[model samples]
Target: MAIKLLSQFLVILVVLVSLFVNNLVLASEQYKDPIVIGMSAAFTGASKNLGLELYHGSMAYINKINQSGGINGHPLVIKAYDDGYNPLPAIENTVNLVEEDEVTVLFDYVGDPTVTKILPLLKKYEAKNIMLFFPFTGAQSMRQVPYNQYVVNLRASYREETAGLVDHLLGIGHKRIAVFYQIDAYGRSGWDGVRKALEKYGLDIVAETTYRRGTEYNSSFNPQVQILQEADPDAIISIGNYQACAGFIRDARDANWDIPIANVSLVGSESLLKLLLETGRKTQRDYTQNLINSEILPSYEDLSLPAVKEYRNAINSYRGKSPITKENYTESGYNYVSFEGFLNAKLMVEILKRWTDFSDQDQLHEIVDHLNDFDLGIGVSLQFKHPEHQGLHQVYYTTVSNNKFVPLKDWRKWSK
Candidate 1:
């Protein structure tokens, strides 16, 4: 009877121990699942090209990291959703990513309207490890928020790029300048930048114009062109995306207005180049010659740089069957996505390495807050602080010549 009782007690003990072990295994599995990074982009519709480039670049980096054993032995997974460059869908996608998917970070989508709708949700959820990288929109509202705790802007701010363009024009002795900007926050930011930069030279804009997005302003450009021509500005600065800028350029040229034309970094893409070329308008040639493109990454065509070579090798190795074609291989857009995503992933990995256990959210936030002036490689560096969330503050200038973008100057730190 004593032996039988001992045997029953041992069995009960084994069962309890087994249950506890099983629960621990389950918890570990839940934690080990790929650290989810959510992406909001325009996968469909007009801005699909931008989305495709961003997705490919980000996925390429993710694949490279996973092949090398991932972030602290846990794979990084990207959960992407198409917002079609619309605000409502973007907001809905943000809610789903945070509440349902429980993503660790959020990749940016294009357009100010869409991002504006999602900002409050990010704050409301207190998504601890969440950060937005390489946002397509450069609105001041996105970058200048009072307590943007979890946001990290990758691109040079609209104001910075605009000032750079204006300074370059001023250096060339272009005194009279005309401005054409989109009628939105993004456009307004560039307008303000131009205004401030010109103030330094004691010069003011000779003529200024605005256009609404998704509207046909090609015909209406006649009066605006006449006004700019009458003003006889030595240069014209465009602060909008491809469509409106293209129309403005074409109309200006058709009206026999020949002057140096400069545009924001948003206009520095293959789509914009293709649109200009496809129109076969004389303005395309003039615009291409005079257009000054600004970039936030090293030029892919410059093989002298180690980072560019690595990026080239990555694209060649990973994209085997569907290789990036010569016609579509500018690397500006791809470099932006990869550079931002890789840096974010690297920062996360660094944080993980510093922690022996990943159970504390406060520690994670503190580490991220303390991350400042960390160099990633090939001139890409990040600086994050408690008050300032804009991680990157550098921009590179380049120009498209002979169907290739050539670097004009070395990387320069941007000033407010």
Candidate 2:
């Protein structure tokens, strides 16, 4: 009887050992596979610069990691699809990313309308624990109650940006403000923010005008400019993409309407400047004058910030080298949109470093929530907790100086 019991015990031990070895082998294989992050942004529309630069900026850091041996020996890759800044394509691309590509996470999405339309997918995949990381827009829809849990934001919200713009304008003694925005959720988000900010002072927007989304640089914004001119606002806050905003600015300046015009960061400052400068040269007008842009990130020209230095180094070292960079994609030196994208990649990697197991998506929120008081060397402390998903709160303002966007130091210069 003792001999028979010993043999049975040995058989059970062998079975246990076999199971353990097989599990170990499976885990090893999974770890060796590349971790893919999916992205959907405009690559062919008027907002293409935002998508392209954002992708390039992200890939600069990501490529640096991959070259040195990626996170825990697993290469990080982004499978991107162009949505052309439209809602329908964004939905299609997102669906394909979740259903077909099955990427580990979503990162660096662009545009408010696109991001807003895709928020419902997070709920649909709630069981899968899918979350979007650091999309480009600052719209409030994703930051609000129901959808906030599904997304982690790296930048300040549109509300915060508009508030800062209003505060400075008010501080400089400009009370009668106006707004020019795209006719979409994004524009409405900024408009709402401006309205709320002005309401605190018992004032409201002096006038408002709207332009359709995807309006090109060549499209005439004279009508919108005419409407705002009639209202004779002290300042105008524009909430739209680079193309539409540039068109409006060109027309406003061409019409000799020199009222202070402020744009939210989503305007893609570099792209707007490029268009306006080109038109200004042709028309012999300085369209960049009296222009101000609210930014969520510091100026790339500021080499004092550690993050900015790192960004310039990474961009110079990795431009046109990222695996996803297309042959046709040209580098536009350094710009805010891409700089924000570089920061987005840096933050994502920081979040990922805290995770040992990528298989369980449920752990993402817990991991992010625990990242408290973390510093990214960006001259500010970043925090993420259960209720608050946004990591950064600082808003910056910039205006064109010497053909580049620099930090706004004196609000009195623009005071009407």
Candidate 3:
């Protein structure tokens, strides 16, 4: 009888211990696990500056929120992989993020080719009810249907950006536009926007030149630069990344081709300005007057608006001061990409909070369907109605001044 009782007590104690261990694991899985976001962008190679700016900006906001206690009891974490702005590596990073890391969302990928190549994966996941949110490129794919069903864009389209530039230049009576572009889908997209914009004015590009994609700014731009110099259009519209575009401008100036240079927002305004300043041929005034870079948001330094003020505070406060993670960022301070990244985080969190249920992708889609006419502070609003994937229709024009991007206040008044 004594042996029987002792055996019985041991069995009961074992059962209780197993139950406790299981409960502890369940609790850990539930409470300690954070909400993961994965990013695949060019963190190295020629496009490093662009990638870091966007990454830093998005992470800055995310870090701020998590420090304050996170979203609905879950912390926000970002995992990033450097794809060198290439497609093959992007595919690998994305697959791992989806299947292994199991991130809750994907955000702010730079480069049109990267986004274009990844759309099929985005669709594959969408079939499983997963969505890719707020990619960085304003490519037409993100703005078109079926694909747009899976993507939720936060900015104006490349077409809209280019049109704004053409209209403003036309307003000032500068035609005879020439174009220089990278030889890729990304470059082609910008070229097309320019073509369409010029078509509206019954005009055509005076000269068009191309450079092989993925080369650095220091690459031989002399051939293209010489071509443009010979044509000598009133203004040259450069549709490429900052380094290459900056190189073209630098080379053009070297050739004494002093006509105005125009660039779409993807040109990396801060990087381009930095290159010009470092080269020492152009002063702040020289750049602010002769060179123009169109923007989706006003100059980062323009803190007059309520949203701009908030952006300033967030990026300045959080920029590069945090513990390091899978991704690295520049402490070089706030600019267009980082500010845009901060805005991306804000927009994501806002839409996410309204999600009917976190796990229901269908519900998220429903929310996106009605996400139009949304207010995003700074007195700016968004319209995301169906058949129109672009949330923001307006683009801001900027020029470098005082070593920074200064809003052309006149352009805004005229842009309207």
The per-prediction tally of clashing pairs is 0, 0, 0
User: What TM-score would every model get versus the actual structure?
Assistant: 0.78, 0.91, 0.87
Winning model by lDDT: 2
**Tens-place lDDT digits, model 1, residues 186-266:** 677788888988999999988888877544323356766776787778888887766667677777766666576777766
Pairs with backbone N, CA or C atoms under 3 Å apart (clashes), candidate 2:
none
Model 2 alpha-carbon drift over 4 Å, by segment: 1-31, 321-325
Residue 59 CA displacement from its true place in model 2, Å: 0.2
- Output the TM-score of candidate 2: 0.91
lDDT per residue for candidate 3 within 234-292, as digits (tens), equals 78788888889888887777766777788888888888888777776534224334788
Best model per TM-score: 2
What is the Cα-based lDDT of residue 360 in candidate 3?
Answer: 89
User: Candidate 2, after superposition: displacement of residue 89 in Å?
Assistant: 1.1
Of models 1 and 2, which has the larger TM-score? 2
